[model samples]
Target: MLIVAIILSLIFGSLGFIVTINNAKYLLSGYNTMSEADRAKMDIAGYLRFFKRFHIFLSVTLLAGVLLLYLFNHNWASSYMVLYPLLAYAYLLAKGNTFYRGTSGQKSGTYIGIAILLVVIIAVGSGMFTSLKNSEIVVTESQLEIRGAYGIKIPKADLTNVSVVKQLPAISIKTNGFAAGDYAKGSFRTTEGRKVKLFVNKEAPPFLLLNTREDEIYYSSDEVSSNDLYKKIKKWQKE
Candidate 1:
């Protein structure tokens, strides 16, 4: 449900951005191929007026979707909500490239290159702002359940070890995942060649570490009592 809300929010938010004068060209066929002088002489007053109202409507709808996500405690999806606009912008650029090629007789290769560059920027930006918010760990006798960006369910039968630590060991590389600022939410490889999945906010401490036969995972939660969590998991491990 939250995923759907996020998709809707992104769709609406991106449309609002594309309708703006400065950014509209990305979606306007032939706009990219137009020389600055030609662009300057173009009349977009009608489009401006129409998009202005449309932007408002979409913005309002996006806010409502975000509100619902928040009210329902679907916070993991909401944590990265700000990225929706950029995702939308990327969509527009790709779409615009298609339209521009069809109408402007521009070669596809050139526009494809530009589109790739724009996509790289959005992907990097999204990674930098990646954070671990509204995440939780549920420890049971049979398995450990994670609810967040790197969510999963780990059976006790696969667990080789479990511990709570104040800080993570040095990570050599992120094998596949997201990292931004002090938050590292994704899969990473350690200097010791351990494959670890992390969902962390650097500001928070006392992380839970789980070692299955095949992988290691580190996760934390600000909303839950870390000491109590440690005790519960410890009990489960002994069982």
Candidate 2:
């Protein structure tokens, strides 16, 4: 997650240079689409300067905020990554109205854009908050159920093996799932090119490894003892 944050910061920082006066007509979004008459009324140079400053500030502040959050709680850092930029962009759009002198249609588009951003922020923030909660584990006579985001139920018959391990294979990337801070849940590709399901905290040790006919599962939680869970599953397997 930190790595991802760093990459994003660098990318945002670079945007200041990517869109310059020479390429504003081709690369700038709203300005590029405007008719010459409309464009003539706007302050393109001032807007560009504002754009550069916004991105640079966002880049530096995002990195600094993430670093601070990382020291306290990784989950918060992850949330910050998503929240900061979105809120910042929304602020940018609101402040940008002063630099734009387009028609009512264009002004309406900016308002619509801000509204959409707010909706997205709320949706994503809520989802992340839910996912950060500890996943529930329910063992029934017929199956082991994992309840929460990216959860699954493994039938007892298909469960081939269950054991505790200290380390996980190198994860290549998330194919389909949620990963934030030390929390990772869902499908991920291993360095060996194998797909696996994970519901574990990377910073936590001693994960329960469950092998089924269709998938390999790695499970852990900051709220649960993995060794105890492993023992329980082993006893359940024998029955």
Candidate 3:
């Protein structure tokens, strides 16, 4: 995740340098699409200068914010990684309107940009809210159910082993799922090359490991004691 943040920061930061006045006609989005008369009405040079400075500042701030959040082990670090860039772009579009002269086309473009930004903000916010919730584990008569994002149900017939371990296997990559701060919920590949479903807090200990015929699941939550949950699952399995 840290690597992903760093790479994104670098990519966005470099964009300002990439779109120069000479290449603005071919590279910049709105500017490239503008009619010659419409382009003439705008202060392209001034906007480019503003653009360069704004993106540089955005990149630096994003990198710094993520680093600080990660160092403190704040769960918000994950949210910051996504939301900061989006909010920055929103600011960019809002402030960018000032550089456009009274061009009707530019006004329409600005409206479209604002509309898209709002939609993206709402979507990302909704997903973050869902992923941040703690996963719930429920035991049924014939199967075990894990509830919340990336949830799944496992039949009792598939259970092969159930135990509690002090530590988790080292995760190599998140194949499909969410990982923020110490909280991780999703599919991950271990350093040993085993794929597992994890709903565990990395900083918390005594994770419940359930080995099934098809997959290994590691689970932990602040809402329940892992040791107690392990015992319950073990007892339930026998019945």
Candidate 4:
């Protein structure tokens, strides 16, 4: 069950991020409304619709994948994590003032898109909370360690280690694949005790994937000096 959960989480998370990047690229490549084309010549709706299509479809697929992930694991609650991805995607599509009041098209596409994005976000966020409401938690002391691409190249010794409650606030799913969340480039101790989480925030979208990078990271769930561990990763990256 644990392995399945991990795999499904990773797969769904990866899919969500992938669709987001592609959508971003496809949307930004062609149009910038600021350029004033002749009013009669311009097809505002048509131009904007191209970008909107990619995001709309991507959001739908991402949400569907998230749902399947939860159903497969019977974790109907963790499903709310889907909102993170949804918000990221929605904001991307709706953030700009794509709608104008003078036009009859004012509330047609853009309004509905924004509305859908918002509604789904609220629905899923509610689910994430209820899912974890009734679960058992175990805590115990452990050790700290760091790892890398090739293998466990670092020991727990170079950096500062802070131990907080094992509870990590649900990170936005859109930021899940990118370094948009708390652990974008850092490490987190996944265990319930003595775990330390590192925060990294230097990633670009469409390329550097957070969850994928996460798999190659190290966790320090126990109390330990991180001197040796940090050095190992530094040296390894250099090599």
User: If scored against the real structure, what TM-score would every candidate get?
Assistant: 0.49, 0.94, 0.90, 0.27
Worst 10-residue lDDT window for candidate 2 reads 100-109
Expressed as tens digits, the lDDT of each residue in 1-239 for candidate 4 is: 23433464556445534433325334442233323332234344553554455445554555555556655643342343445556766665554434332343543555687788798788656644433222111112222232321112223232222222223433333222222112232333344432222332112111111122224332332223234334543444344
Error of model 2, residue 178, in angstroms: 1.4
Q: lDDT of each structure?
A: 0.64, 0.90, 0.87, 0.38
Q: Least accurate stretch of 10 residues (summed lDDT) in model 1?
A: 98-107
Number of clashing residue pairs in every model? Answer: 0, 0, 0, 18
Q: Report lDDT (Cα) of residue 180, candidate 2.
A: 88
Error of 3 at 24 (Å): 1.5
| Alpha-carbon lDDT of model 3 | 0.87
> In candidate 2, which residue pairs get closer than 3 Å at backbone N, Cα or C atoms, i.e. clash?
none
What is the overall TM-score of model 1 with all chains considered together? 0.49
Expressed as tens digits, the lDDT of each residue in 1-239 for candidate 2 is 67888999999999987999889989988778888898887788999999999999999999999999999999999999999999999998888878977678778888999999999999999999988877778899999999999999999999999889999989989999998878889999999999999998888888889999999999888788999998889999899
Top-scoring candidate (lDDT): 2
The true-versus-predicted C-alpha distance at residue 185 of model 3, in Å, is 1.8
- Global fold similarity of model 3 (TM-score): 0.90
Range of the 10 consecutive residues with the lowest summed lDDT in candidate 3: 102-111
- What TM-score does candidate 2 reach? 0.94
Candidate 1: residue pairs that collide: none
Candidate 1: where is the Cα deviation over 4 Å? 1-131, 191-193
